[model samples]
Target: MTGGIQAQIERVRAELTSRPEGLQRHVGRVLTEALDLARAWDVDPDRVELATWGHDLFRAASPAELVTMARAAGVAVEAPDLAEPVLLHGPVAAAVLEARFAVSDDEVLAAVRDHTLGLSEMPMLAKVILLADKVEARKRQRAPVMKQIRRLARRDLDLALLCWADWKWVEERTHGWQSHAQHWHARAEWVRQHHGEVALPPRVPETADN
Candidate 1:
């Protein structure tokens, strides 16, 4: 990491240290995942690390606080985003990082914005951060399907994203949450277009009786 990036990391670390212990542990896990994936994927470690640190900076904000922050940051507060501010935390976090720390790199800011709800054609750095955030070690209470996605992340990043999007779609449908349906659909479509089909391991073909 460059001196500049190291300085940013220190600043973020200090800020996180003041937060609740649970939040700090979550950020630590995300950072670890980001660094490991960055090295494996040949992405810019500095960018991924910085984005991970700031991705959840405002995750605990109340709905009212989310609206205020979005307005302050000039991010349009649509009806859906306002109604379900949990989905807006990513964008709100990005805005806060940019405004407070002068983070100007669009990619880093984009990663922070898109980490929770991925974009149609996400950058590789953003993909890394997104997957890292989902599969971080501290997140141990995931369902079986989520465990599979986390395992897939160790082998193929694209496949991991596809699995995650697929799982998220099922979750939304089960919970009747439509706020992020478009995002999940767009990400799934993008993965299909770019990486072709993805699936679970196929069963071995039965040998013909001899």
Candidate 2:
């Protein structure tokens, strides 16, 4: 597994000087980091690629269709559990791995399923995927998200998830955001499921004198 990963890295690096060089490198780094996280968490090394491979699939997705597309893939998605971190690709990948590749490897599915928000009962690989997405350099907007990721890296998953919920709130409030609040509502459900608070952080103060 390690050898295969190393080979993949080499291939990615070799293409770093090609078209969209920066993007290629960024993808390479994210892939490497995700694999590293998986290994550190004692995930099956062979299954680490699932996280590294598709961590950024949604990068180009229309934010509005992100969860919809994931849900459209066909799996028994629970109402609240159907949101967040699961929409993060944990279940989609799990289903893909099961139905397509017939891998039936628990660790791989676990890594994919929990890559986004987080699971209440996080498996090793799941945590790795979460951290990998949160810390990847391509996600370099150091405002709210970076702040929370750095703070939550060494802390509790539930706490980190709360911070992410705050980040989601900010996005919803951002100008020209074309997405809906389904994920927010969905996240609220997850927060309730996990016994956490469901409130978004206080809105960025509007100019009082405006």
Residue-pair clashes per prediction, in order, are 0, 3
lDDT of 2 by residue, 16-123 (tens): 345354555665666666666554445565556645554443444343454665567775555444443335345554555455445455665666665655554656
User: In model 2, where is the ten-residue run with the lowest total lDDT?
Assistant: 8-17
Assess candidate 2 and give its lDDT: 0.55
Candidate 1 stretches greater than 4 Å from native: 1-3, 179-182, 194-210
Model 1: per-residue lDDT, tens digit, 69-161? 899889878888867888888998888877887788889999999898888777888988998898877564666566677677768887788
Error of 1 at 18 (Å): 2.5
Per-candidate TM-score against the hidden true structure: 0.85, 0.52
Candidate 2 local lDDT, residue 188: 72
In model 2, the Cα lDDT at residue 164 comes to 69
Candidate 2 Cα errors over 4 Å, as ranges: 1-26, 35-45, 56-94, 113-124, 141-148, 176-186, 189-210
